[model samples]
Target: MSEWRGVAQGCAVIVGVLLAGLAGAGIWIAVYMQGDPQPDVAKAARSHTARAADLLVTAHVDQQLAQLRTALPWATHLGTTVADICETYPANTGFTRRTWTPVMCTRTGTAYLAFDGDFREHLAQLDTALAAEGWKPTNNAGDQPGLVADLDYTHRPPGDATAAELAEAAARPNVATVRYTLPIPSTFAVPPGAGGGPFPIGTVEVAQAPHLPTIDDGTAAHDLTLETRHFVDWQPYSHTQLSTAYPAHGAILAISVRLPYNT
Candidate 1:
């Protein structure tokens, strides 16, 4: 009877040991199957593919060309409108801050950004980036870089060569370089009938630091006042109409002058 009991105990101990070994083997297999470490080759291949894709894009700009092709016609009208905003700011007395606020918030508006910076003297700089993309920023101490100002383009009758001579002598390389120092008025006003005499009916105090040359560079003309009916609001030229982004900003001015290039 004792021998049988001992034999049974020995069998149980062997079974226990075998079960423990099986459990240990199972744990080892589970750990091995799970993700243990980063896969070096796969990571390297993925990085290489990303770099290749970037290179492929840089090597080709057809995507940009395609986008421009679809957007050019609209861009032309928008550009012209922007030109009007700039050309007319100094002329309109009825324009308000609300209307001109977005003038410098976008591309061509950026060109006039500086003007906005100092309202006492000028409007916001028009961002020319839209019209002249990637063009370097320009500054000429309040002068619009290429603007031709004070240019008398009208020709005299056959006898008077003086007018023709003056116009010829004043021809400048870049019309935009013609700088104008406009007098800041105490108030904005237009009296009785419209479109008469020295606009704005106020004194324009010109800055004397940079002396005005004998030939007018369009730098001294300042007191501007536009008639109510002739006044054009800046709305259709907004980003919505201009960009694929937002709506057109309100307009504040409109200038129709024949300058150097017929001005």
Candidate 2:
């Protein structure tokens, strides 16, 4: 009986030790979580940067296009010509000189002008203009000369707040602040051997947002954004036939100033 009693006491001690250890672990976890909370800076900055990039690109394109148009008025309307021919046989056409005669030739055309100018100089001017507007240029190594820029911006709430309050404020859509830097471009020149010509250009591209939120913000906002990057890419020197469907040049303009409220 004494042995059985000792065994029972040992089991009770083991159970007590386990319960105490579990309680201590729980307390440590709670303290750690409270001390090191997840940050909202990355999330807020991403949201703000995306919207700001869209707005800035739109404004930049509009201003640049206006400037280009004013400088080169002839670029507005270009013209192209097409020819049609009709053939007829003469009455005395027996293996003779007048066997076949040209009856009529018709020509049709349109006033759609192709882009022309000193493209390299124009690109330089655009780069200068973008620099004056607070955009920093990025260096890219390739055959074609290109212009890329980055802009950084930040925002904060109007009033003072504690860390906890600031964190909570960040959670609030209206109170939270954001900061980010995004790379953009003003113009791009298609590389040689692209088949379009020696100076094909890609101005702008508009498409849906490249990134979507993983978590729902309850706003159901679905909108598009512009991808100024890859406005032009290099084509290798080869004798391969060029695709006929590709555009020789492009000058698309898209602008959006509204901030992403629920992104």
Candidate 3:
């Protein structure tokens, strides 16, 4: 009977210890909670840096293209006037944190008649202008210097190119195409604001879109096409290939600038 009583007292002590431990834990949690209120993320502004980066890069594209227009008044814009997009990425591999970066693309083609005299001088001048704008010319494709403009018959069928047209394209290979890159110094690490999860892959929520002078008629649509070919295609800009269907047999230049993001 005494042994039974001792066992009961021991069990009671064990239960009391557990209850005390639980109570301490609860008190600690309450104190921790009291220290800082949960952030009212609802009131926070959507990332200014993300949007600023978007606008900055897009403006860079517009400015560069306008410069090109000034240098070569007769130069024709091929494809979309420009592909200015800010692509979102997960800062971590777990896809919890989000960040965004901007990429701008543009292409221009000139007439074959003007290719000989005007193209060379104008292209050099444009290069100088771009260099002044903090864009460095790179011959390395891996540098992701943006897109290179060229006569692209790859999308067309094998027999799509006639022997004469191919010869003509080959004969006039004086088109000057250059790619440029603008290195971004800041990391665009955007916090998850009032919203949860990152922005949709193909969509850009830029506040400055309405006030912009020129409409981006080509980039989003081409991005959609690219999404089909390669799922969630972050890079819509590539070799700005002028198809045989489109007669762009002049000076060709493609520019791409990829923004920085947190890893």
Give all candidates' CA lDDT scores: 0.26, 0.30, 0.37
Judge candidate 2 at residue 246 and give its lDDT. Answer: 19
100-202: candidate 1 lDDT, tens digit per residue = 1101101011111001122212211222211232222223432433121111211112345577675665442211223222221223222223333322111
User: What's the distance in Å from true for residue 23, model 2?
Assistant: 3.0
Winner of 1 and 3 under lDDT? 3
lDDT computed for candidate 2 = 0.30
Give per-residue CA lDDT, model 3, range 141-204, as digits (tens): 3323312221122122236778876776655544333434454333233333413233211111
Model 1 residue runs over 4 Å out of place are 40-50, 58-72, 75-244, 249-263
Between prediction 2 and prediction 3, the one with superior TM-score is: 3
RMSD of each: 27.5, 30.5, 13.0
Each prediction's TM-score against the native? 0.24, 0.27, 0.35
Per-residue CA lDDT of candidate 2, range 50-99, in tens? 34543443354345344433544424322221111111224243433333
Clash pairs of candidate 3?
A: none
Name the regions of candidate 3 deviating beyond 4 angstroms: 1-49, 79-129, 132-134, 140-178, 183-251, 257-263
